[model samples]
Target: MKKMIAVMSGLAMIMTVSSTVYADFGFATEPDEVAAVVQAYIDEKLPGKAVIEISEAGEVIVKINKTSFLNPNQQVNILTENLRSYLLSNDADYSIVRVVYDEEATQPAEPTGPEEPAEPEEPAEPEEPAEPEEPTEPEKPAELVDPEKPEEPEKPTESTEPVEPENPAEPAKTIKPGDLDSSGTIDVTDLTEVSLALLGDRNLTDDQLKAADVDGDGTLSLADLAKLRQYLSKKIDSLD
Candidate 1:
């Protein structure tokens, strides 16, 4: 009788612990339709022990019971990245997401094993070649060039007053085809120069960088970089 009472007490405690730990979710999807997709994704990206519980949350299907088939002793950053990629690829519309992790009850779940770099996602079969983007129609810069190219200055004209070199007839806007950085125009020869300058393989004059940054977010992140290359490519091809 005493043993039975002890077992019942333990089961009651377990139920209370589970109820306190389980979190609610707001995401939605047809559970049966995407269950396989979600399961497959979990199996591949997470090789070790991790928990993935998929079920209906009220009207929506979800994996509210976040656990691991792999040991939960994994790097949080790596786990976050894997989760972000999974969410972004399959369901971009559902950006409003909440990831509730149990701090007290959770383990430092990191993959103890060596990690393989994620494989590149296969590109969707091209229905047609991608449409070419429109050119970057940038306004002409202010005239800073002199009318004529002066002979090289032999020495400083004045101790305090610096000599102003004569500018060419006009500022050259014609960029050669291989001028990737688009600073007044450097070519493959400028690759090293650029790399040395700001860690880019090609140098970018202030003007070129401004033109490349369409959103003006003051960042050369992947999106801005892609736009910059696209603009230069369009202009170069047009010249041909």
Candidate 2:
């Protein structure tokens, strides 16, 4: 009676441990879910003759049969690549242990002997030649030189006067810095134009752009706007 109670307790303990493991690893509630997935993967790769066995203890075994054979270590390489990738990516815990291969599962079928080479055929007899015809004369070579020579080109006359270089384009007019509206003075309108340019709605011309570069940094950024505002408020004498 005591032994019977102990055995029942042991069974209950086993069930509790199994449930704990499944909960921790996110194992499927259905007993066949993982096994079915593994079976399908093996079926797709090895077709009808390969079997996959997944144990409740998280062990995996691959069995290759005689009816289907892989091409020399192809089974090992394919399984290692496919299973490791699937587990690492899809398995909740990214863990797989005790993967075993059944090497002596079944004997591979013997290959048929190589085919014999076909016998060579004899050469056919040559036909009789026709009577020799009279030898024909060779054609004359083409003429090497033309009868007339080309006329010589006339030389251009040299100019006695010296040539003058073209005048360069006038440089852009330099304006006082912060003169955004080209009013020749820093005013509220110039500050408003600079603000609009900074907002990106309005564009400034080359001279205006240079003028608005109050910090002389060669760029018309927000710092230029701040400088212009400070200048308008009499915070500074000139941006130069």
Candidate 3:
């Protein structure tokens, strides 16, 4: 009975060691290959550093380095979902155990040599004073000219007829509301123009603005766009 108990104890010890060895050494496929694939996927999808580790139990551990500009939790969730789908699609049995942000170790700053002092600038020399100009001689007085006599005015001829004024120019044609393209009818083209205007991709003319303001609120807004779309889709009878 004592011998039997010792044998069972030895077998249990061997089994425990074997399990540990298998876990440490990895499973059937190389863990490095799995890690490489995971790293590649992370590099392609995200814009940060990541460390990938694999266990014998087919668990993929991902440590994502934290960044100041992004939300770590959100990034982890996104990566988790996408990577899981990607691995499953490729028939990979390995599953992501957990993805967490790791605080990266701060690198030590390099020691810098002492800076040299700047040299003092030399003082500028003073400018010399300008020389005085010589005095000019006085000019002689000119003689005065005599004024000319004025000519007599001519007499005007009398007319009996009166002149008529020219006709005024015609007024500009008014553009119909919602007819942005001025195609004589509102259609998809007009809708596209309104969409472009709303998106700030295209500048609308005064007439186009008036036409695009289907709601007549004096501004082209999403409400106007919705009304225009409804009119086009026949959800409503007219933009009016």
Total clashes for model 3: 0
Question: What's the best-to-worst order under lDDT?
Answer: 3, 2, 1
Give the per-residue lDDT of model 1 (tens digit) for 1-240.
Answer: 999999999999986665455322323234442444444555675433334434345221222223544433444444555655775576421223223344333223656888889999998886987889999989999978685978676985657667788786886565443244556553433333333434555666765555444445765445544443444556434212
Clashes of each: 17, 0, 0
Q: lDDT (CA) for every model shown?
A: 0.48, 0.70, 0.74
TM-score: which is higher, 1 or 2?
A: 2
Tens digit per residue, CA lDDT, model 3, 1-240: 999999999999997886577557553234565566666676676545666666677666787766456688887787678776765555443443457677762223559999988888888888888888888878867855545755568777787688777777878878787898888998999989888888889998888999999888898899988898898899999877
Q: What residue runs in model 1 are displaced by over 4 Å at the alpha carbon?
A: 1-28, 33-35, 55-77, 92-240
Rank all candidate structures by their TM-score, best first, as comma-separated numbers: 3, 2, 1
**Model 3 whole-model lDDT (C-alpha atoms):** 0.74
Best by TM-score: 3
Collision count of model 2: 0
RMSD of 2: 20.2
lDDT by residue for model 2 (1-240), tens? 999999999999998898689777876434255555566566566565556656667655557644336653665666666766665454422244323456455334559899899888878889899889999999999867765876678888886787788899998677788877777678999888888888898878888888888899998898998888888788988787
Q: Which stretches of candidate 2 lie over 4 Å from their true place?
A: 1-165
Clashes of 1: 17
